[model samples]
Target: MHYAPTWAADGDTRRRPPLVGDEREILTSYLEWHRATFELKCSGLPADRLSEQSVPPSGMSLHGLIRHLAGVERWWFHIQFAGEKVPMLHYSDEDPDQDFDDLSGDPAQALALWREQCEHSRGIVAAAPSLDATGIHAASGDPVSLRRVLVHLIAEYAQHNGHADLLRERIDGATGS
Candidate 1:
């Protein structure tokens, strides 16, 4: 069945971080909330509009963010934390910014991949015994803990969500991410 993306009210969909919780619970909740915020920013937009870049010289777009975050989710959760040997997605040393530069792919597909990555990340986190568990950092080849990964992903999403906020506003004057 074909489904059209729709945006619901913030309170209805967005999850607030728990007032009290363990460190892992708090961290994961914040990360998940930010992930939802990014998706919410892109909600209800058509494919063409999702690929619309900002004013010249700035290649930032909602579609680009979706692709970029998808790569990041896989990199940190699947490859780095879970030690999965998956091929890179929408990224390469030859074209480091391909995620933002290549707008040829369908936005719907990019969004779907991002959602899948998010689900995979959650599973990885759930299976992990403790936040102290360590994994290799893809770039530095240094050991990093699940806590670090969660924090980094949260910061990454926060930064990209800011970009998404501006991009969405530019696209159709929609505010609040």
Candidate 2:
């Protein structure tokens, strides 16, 4: 089945990463690409479809993925890096999987939340002194650099985007980048 273009229309010069760039730029570029890919996977679908846990036996849905990513971005950047005293997003000791399990919220709102988190992440990255800047890992209480967080976030998006692909395909026969 046909799907909308995964990216912008032809000739639309997006803020794409160059073939060559500095370390920080390259990492951020790759991270941004994965972020866009995840969004692309979620586009052009209704709320009900986005909330559908297509792959049964695993309560994973596109809406859930969006929530999860938003939480992740906040955790890594605002909470972990910036050490903000903000409340956790979609998470708790009792309901750790709430982001992935709770599908009652509006999908549009979930997506908007994710976008906002992404914007915050971009701001955090842009304002940082350098990729080598250190942040404490909440769990381990050990120092973790901004570079490490960027790579981790990129990997997270890549893995979940794969899930989004399968979920989308199962919802409708649509597939591919």
Q: TM-scores of the models, in the given order?
A: 0.92, 0.90
| Each prediction's RMSD to truth | 5.1, 4.9
Q: Identify the candidate with maximal TM-score.
A: 1
Model 2 lDDT at residue 122: 95
Writing each residue's lDDT as its tens digit, candidate 1 over 76-155 gives 99999999999979888999999999999999999999999999989999999999999998889999899999999999
Runs in model 2 with CA error above 4 Å? 1-16
Query: Residue 60, candidate 1: how far off, in angstroms?
Result: 0.7
Question: For candidate 2, lDDT tens digit of each residue in 1-177?
Answer: 112234465433325565677888888987887888788788888888999999999899999999999999999999998888888889878998899888889999999999999999899999999999988988899988999999899899889989999999999977874
Clashing pairs in 2: none
- Looking at candidate 2, the ten consecutive residues that score lowest on lDDT are 1-10
TM-score, predicted candidate 2 vs. hidden true structure:
0.90
lDDT of 1 at 141: 92
TM-score (C-alpha, index-matched) for candidate 1: 0.92
